[model samples]
Target chain A: MQPVQPLQSVTSAHTDRSLQLTLFIVSLVTASVLGLIVLFIFRETLPALSGPGMLRFVTDESWHPLENQFGMLPMLWGTLASTALAIFLATPLGIGAALFCRYFAPRPIVRPFRALITLLAGISSVVFGFWGLTVLVPLIARFEPPGASLLAASLILTIMILPTVALMSEAAINSVPESYSGGAAALGLSKGATIRQVILPAAKSGIFAAVILATARALGETMAVLMVSGNVVQTPGSLFDPIRTLTANIALEMAYATQFHRSTLFVSGLVLTFVIAALAIAAHRVEHRAGSHHAA
Target chain B: MQPDSSVSCAPGLMAAPSVAGSTLLTAQVHAKLSERLFVAAVWLAAALVAASFLWIVADIAFHGFAKLSWSFLTEAPRSSGRKGGISTILVSTLLILAVTVAVAVPLGVGVAVWLSEFSRRSSRTARVINIALDVLAGIPSIVFGLFGNAFFCVFLGLGFSIVSGGLTLACMALPILIRATESGLSAVPHDWRQGAAALGLSKAAALWHVLLPAAAPAITAGLLLGIGRAVAETAALVFTSGYVDRMPESLMDSGRSLAVHIYDLSMNVSGGDQAAYASALVLIGLLIVINAVAIQLSNRFMKSRIQPA
Candidate 1:
C-alpha cells in the first residue's frame, strides 16, 4: 500500500510538471510571434532601406513607381495630415462624451449610451468605408468635384476612433478616487468647477494615453482611408484635396508590386510599425504613471 | 436746483448697498448660466456620438435592406457582385474564422494561464510577455498583411490562401484574446485557489475543474471579440487570401472574405454599390449579434457570481 501511494504521488507530480512545461512552451512561442513579425518585415524592407535610392525614398515627393521614383513624403504627409485632423476632430467630442457619461448623464441612460459606443466600435472598418463611399462621398461631391478626399477619410476615421477615445477617457475618469470628489464637495466647489479643476487634472495623464492610443488606431486604419482618400500619391495643399496615406499606399499597390516596388511598400509598412511602436511606448509610460499615481 | 439735488442725494444714499448686492447676484447668475451651457454641450457631444452610430446603421439598412433576399444569402455572386448573392464569401469567412479561432484560442488561453496562474505578476518573464503582447497589439493590420505575405505566403510556400490569411489574423487577434482572458483569470478569487489546495487536489485538476469554468464566460467573450475583429478584417486578408470569389474547397484554396468582398465590390467594380451595401448589412449584422452575445454572457456571469452559494 505504501509503495503504491508513493508511485501514485510520483505519477501525479510528473503529470503536473509536464503540463506546466507544455504551457510554458506554448507561451514562449506566442511571445516570439511579435519578434518573428518584426524580423520578417524588417528583412523584406532591407533592400529599399539600404539601396542607393534610400535618400530619395524619403526626400523626393514624386512616387512614380515605374520610373523608379519612390518618394514617400507625400504619402507620409497624407498619413500625418489625416491622422492629425481626425484626432483634432475626435478628441473634443470623445472627451466631452466621456465627461457626460461620468458626471452629467442620468443613471438610466448611461448603460445604453455605453452600449451604443461599443456597437459603434464593433462595426467593421470596411462597412464604414462603404458607407463613406456611397453616402458621405456623394454628400461631399455635391460641393466638390471628387468626393473622395482627405476630408472624407478624416471624417470616417473620426467616427471610427471616437468610441475608443470616449471609452478610455471614461475609464480614466472613473479611476479617479472617490475622495477627491468628496473633498471638492466638502469645500463647496461647484460641480463644474470641481470637474474642471480636480478631476480633469488627476485624470490628465490617462486621457493623454487614451488620445495617443486612438492616434495609433487612426494611423493604422487602411481600408476605410484607402476607399475614401482618392489613392492619389501626391501631397495635398488643402483639406478638400485627394491624398494617399502610407497605409492606403501599401494596401493599394501590394498585389501587383514586384521587386523594388514591393520592397518599397514593405518599407512603408516598416515605417508605420516604428511610428506605432513609439506611440505605444508613450501611451504605456503615461498609463503606468497614472496607475502609480492612483496606487500612491 | 435744491429740489433736484435732494432727490439725487436720496437715491444715491439708497443705491450704495444695492449696487454691491446687484453685482453679487449677476456673478451667481453668470456661474449658473455657464454651468448650464457646459452641461448642454456635453449632452450635445454624447448625442452626436450616438446619433452618428444610428445614422450609419440606418443608412446601410436603408440602402441594403431592400436588396436582401433568401437568394442573396444562398446563391453565388454574379457579375462582380452587381447581382446574385454572397454565399461563397460567407462560407470562406466562416472557414477562415474557424481556423483563426482554432489557432488563437488555445495559444491565447495558454499564455493567459501562464501569466495569471504560474508566474508572479512582478516577475521579469511575465513583464516581457506583457510588453510583447502590448507591442503586438499596437502593430497595424496592414503591417500584419505585409508580414503574412512575406512569411506565410512566400517563405512558407502557403501562397495566397485562406490558411495564410487565417494564420495572419490569428497573430493579429492573439494579443487582445490573451489580455482579456488573463484579466478574467486574475479576477478569480485568491481564496478559491487556497481552497483547492486545501482539498489536496492537483493544480491541473483544480484549474481544469474550477478556475477554467469560472473564467469561461470571459474566455468566451474574448473569443467572440477575436472573431468579430477577424471577420471585419479586409486589409490583412486582401493580400494573403488572393480575392478569389469562388467557393473555397479547402484551407489551401484562395478565397475572398465578406469584408474583402465588400471592399472589392465598392472600390474595384463599378455598379456594384447595391451589392456592397447588402454585404455590409450582412457583415454588420454578424458583428452586432456577436457583441450582443458577449454582453449577455458577461451579464449572466456577473449575476451568477454575485449570487450567494
Candidate 2:
C-alpha cells in the first residue's frame, strides 16, 4: 500500500505541474498580446515623433497634415471637454438610480429593474450614436442650428454610460453590510439619514470607482460620439459648437492617410492609449480596494 | 408660589423632547420635506433609466422593423450601401465574431482556471494579471484599430483583412472573458473542490470534470457579451478590415461588418439613411436576441444544477 501511494502521488504531482505550466503559458500569451499592441502603436508613432517634434504635436492646434503640421490640441480639448460633460451629467443620475434600486425599489421589482439597466449597458454604442445622429442632433438643433454639437454628443454619451455607473454603484451599495443601516436606524435616524450618512459614506470608494470607469468609457467612446459631434476638427467655442474627438479624427481620415499623416494618426492613438491606461489603473486600484474591503 | 416655580422648571426639561413652538414645527417640516425630495429624486433617476431604454428601443423598432424583410436580410448591398440588403456585412460580422471567440475563450478560461483553481487568493502574480486585464479592458477600441493597423496590417502583412480585424477584436474581448470566467469559477463552492480531492482525483481532472461543467453557463454568458462587443465594434475594424462591401472569400480578404456598414451608409453615402436605419434595426435586433438567449441559457443551466441538489 505504501509503494502504491508513492506512485500515485508522483503521477498526481506530474499532472499538477503540467496544469500549472499550461495556465502559465496561456497567461503569458494574454499579457504579451497587450505588450504587442503597445509596442506596435508606439513603433508606428516613431515617424511622427521624429518629423514633428513631440512638443509641437501637443502644443500646435493646426492639424493640417498637408502643411506638414500635426497638432492634436484641438481634438484633445474636444475629447476632454465632452468627456467632462458626460461625467458631470451621468454621476448624479447613476448614483441616484443605483440607490433607488438598492434601497427604495420594492423587492419584487428590483430584479427587472437591474435587468433593464444591464440591457441598457449591452446596447451597442453605434446604436446610441445612430439615435444621437437622428434624434438627439435634431432636438439640439431646435435650440442651436446645425444640431450636431458637443452637447449633443455628451448627452448621448451620458445615456450610454449611465448603466455602467449605476451597476457599479449598485454593487458597491449592496456590499455595505445591512447591519450598518440597521444600526443607524436603531439610533433614531430616519431612513434617509441612515442611507446618506452610513451607507453612502461606506460605499464612497465604490462610487468613485464607478465614476472612473465611466470616465474611461466616455473618453474611449467612438461611434456614437462620432456620429453626433459633427466631425469638425476644431476647438469648440461653446457647448453647441461643433468639434471632433481624437477617435473621430482617426476614424474619419485613417482610410486615406499615408506616410507621415498615417503615423500622426498612430501618434494620436498612442496618446489615447496612455490617457486610458492612466484612468484604467486608477479605476483598478479603487475597485480592488473596494473588493478587498468587501471580502474582509 | 412653590407650585408655579416647580411647573415652570419642569416645562423647560419637557420641551427638549417635544416643543409645540414654531421652531420645532419648522424643523419637523424641514426633515419631512427633504426626505420626500430625496425619494422623489431617486424615483426620477430610475424613471430616467427606464425612459431612455424604452426610447432607444422604440425608435429603432419603429424605424427599422418595417424595413426588415427576407430580401433585406439576404440581398447584397448596392449603390454605396444605399439600397438592397446587408447579406455581406452580416456574414462578415459573423466571421469576425467566430474568430474572436475562438481565440479569446480558451485563453480567457485558462487564465481564469489558473487564478481560481490553482493560485492562492493573495498571490501577487494573480493580482498583476488582474490589473493587466483591467487596463486591457479599459483600452479604447480605436486604439485597437490603430494597433491592428500597425501590427497586423502593416507589419504582420495580414493587410486590411477579416483575419486582422478579428484578431484585434480578440484582444478587446480577452479581458471581458477572463473577468467573467474568473467570477464563474470562483462562484463554484469550495466543497466541490474538497469532495473531488477526497475522491483522490487529480487537480486537472477535478477542474475538467467538476468545476468547469458547473461554470459553463456563466462562461457562455460572458462569451455572448464578448460577441455582442465584436458585433457592435466599428472604429477598430475600420483600420484593420478594409471597407469591402462584398462578403469575404477568405480570411485574408477585407470585409465590412454590420456596424461599419451602418456607419458608412449613414455618414459617407448620400441618401442612404433608409438602409442605415434598416441595418441599425437588424443590429439591435441581433443584440436583443443574443442577450435574451444568453440569459435564458444561463438561468436554465443554473436551475438544472440546483434541482438535483
Candidate 3:
C-alpha cells in the first residue's frame, strides 16, 4: 500500500508539470502567430521592393499593371485623405454623443443607448457598405455624376467608426473621478462649465487615444471602402473625385494579380500593417500615460 | 451690497439691485443661456447618433423584410444571387465558424488559464504576451487575408478553402478570446483556490470542477463575440476562402462566406440588389441574435453570482 501510494503521487506530480508546460506552449502561439504574420507579409513584399527598387513604387503616381507602372502614391493619398476626412467628420459627433450620454442623458435610457451603440458597432462592415451603395450613393449621385466616390467612402467610414469613438470616449469620460465634478460644483461652476473646464481636461488624453484608435480603424477598413469607393487608381483633387485606398487596392487586385502585381499588392498590405501598428502603439502609449496620471 | 451678496449666495438665484447688479445679472444670464445651448447641442448629437442607427435598421428591414421567406432561408443562391436562398452559404458560414471556435476556444482558454493562474502579473513573459495580444487585436482583417493567402493558401497548400479561412479567423479571434477569458478566470475569488488547496484537490481538478464553471459565462460571451466577428468578416475570407458560390463539398473545397457573398452580390453582380438586401438582412439578424444571447447569458450569470446560496 505504501509503495502504490508513492507511485501514484509521482505520476500526479509528473502530470501536473506536463500540464503547465503544455499550457505555456499554447500561450506562446499568441506571440508566434503575430510574428509569423509579420514575417510572411514582409517576405511577400520583398519581391516588389527589390524588383522595383522601392523608389519607383514610392515616387510614381499611376498604378497600371500591364504597362509595368506600379506607383502607390495615389492609393496612399486616398487612404490618408479618406481616413482624415472620416476622423474629422466623426470626432465632433462622437465626442458630443459621449458627453450627452454621460452628463445629459436621462439615467434610465443610458444603458439602452449604450447597447444600441454596441449593436451598431457589431453590424458587419459589408452591410454598412451595402447600405451606402444602395442608399447613400444614389443620394450623392443626385448631386454628382458618379455616386460612388471618395466622399461616399468617407461617409460610410464615418458611420462605421462612430460607435467606436463614442463608446471609447464615453468610457474615458466615465473614468474621470466623480470627485472632479464635486470639486467643480464646490467652486460654484455651472454644470456645463464644470464638464468643459474640469472633466474634459482630465479626460483629454483618453479621448485623444480613442480618436487615434478610431483613425487606425478607418485606415484599415477594407470591404466597406472597397464596395463604396470608386476603385479609381488616382489621387483625388476633390472630395467628390473617385479614389482607391491602399486596402481597397489590395482587395480588388489580389484576385487576379500575378507575380509583380501581386507582390505590389503585398507591399500595400505591408504598408497598411506598419501604419496601423504605429497608430496602435501610439494609442497604447497615450492610454498608458492617462492611466498613470489617474493613478498619481 | 446686493451684488456682493448675490455673488456669495447660490449662483442660481438672481436678486434685483442697482447698476452694478444689473451688469452682473446679465453676465450670469448669458452664462446660463450658453449652458442651455451647449446642452441642447449635445442632445442633438446624441439624437443624430440614434437616428442614424434607426435609419439603417429601418431601411434594411423595409427593403429586405418582404423578400425573406422559408425558401430564401433554405435554398442555394442561383443566377449570381439574383434568385434563390442562402442555405449553402449558411452552411459554409456555420462550418467555418465551427472550425474557428474549435481551434480558438481551447487555445484561448489554455493561454488564459496559464496567464491568470500560473504567471505573475508583472512577469516579463506575461508582459510580452499581453503586448503581442494587443497588437494582434488591432491588426486589420485585410492583412490577415493577405497572410492567409500567402501562408495558408500557398505555403501550407491548403488552397482557398474553408479550412484555410477558418484557421485565419482563429488567429484573428484568439487575442480577444484570450483577453476575455483571462479576465474572467482572474475574477474568480482567491478563497476558492485556497479552499481547493486545503481539500487536497489537484490543480487540474479544481480548475475543471470549480474555476471553469464560474468563468463559463465570460468564456461564452467571448466565444459569441468571436463568432460575431467571424460571421461579419468579408475581407479576411474572400482571399482565404475563395469566392466559389457553389456548395462546398468539404473543408478543402472553397466556400463563400455570407459577408463575401453580400460583397459580391452588391458590388459585382448587376441586378442582384434584392438578394443582396435579403442576405444583408439575414446577416444583421444573426448578429443581433448572437449579441442578445450574450447579453442575456452574462446578465443571468451575474445575477446568479450575486445571489446568496
The model with the greater DockQ, 1 or 3, is 3
Q: Please give fnat for model 1.
A: 0.82
Q: Comparing to the true complex, what docking class would candidate 3 get? A: medium
Q: For residues A67-95, could you state the per-residue lDDT of candidate 1 as single tens digits?
A: 87888899988999999999998998999
CA lDDT, every model vs. true structure: 0.89, 0.85, 0.88
Chain A TM-score for each of the predictions: 0.96, 0.93, 0.95
For residue B289, give model 2's deviation from the true position in Å: 2.2
Q: After best superposition, candidate 3 residue A89: deviation in angstroms?
A: 1.9
Global Cα RMSD, each model? 5.1, 3.9, 2.5
Clashing pairs in 2: none
State the lDDT of candidate 2 residue by residue for B1-309, as single tens digits.
222222221212333443444455555667778889988999998999889889988998898877888999999988888778989888888888888888899998998888787778688887777777888999999899889888889898999999999999999998888877887787787888888988888898898999998888889988888888888888889889879999789988999989888888888898988888899999888887777766676667666653324
Residue B288 in candidate 2 has what lDDT? 78
Candidate 1 structure quality by residue, lDDT tens digits, B96-207: 8888999999999999998999888899988988888898999999999999999999999999999999999999999989987887787788888888877766789889
lDDT of 2 by residue, A34-94 (tens): 7888898888878778853767776776788788777888998899999999999899999
- Alpha carbon lDDT of residue B6, candidate 3? 41
Off by over 4 Å in 2: A1-12, A291-296, B1-20, B295-309
Off by over 4 Å in 1: A1-4, B1-23, B302-309
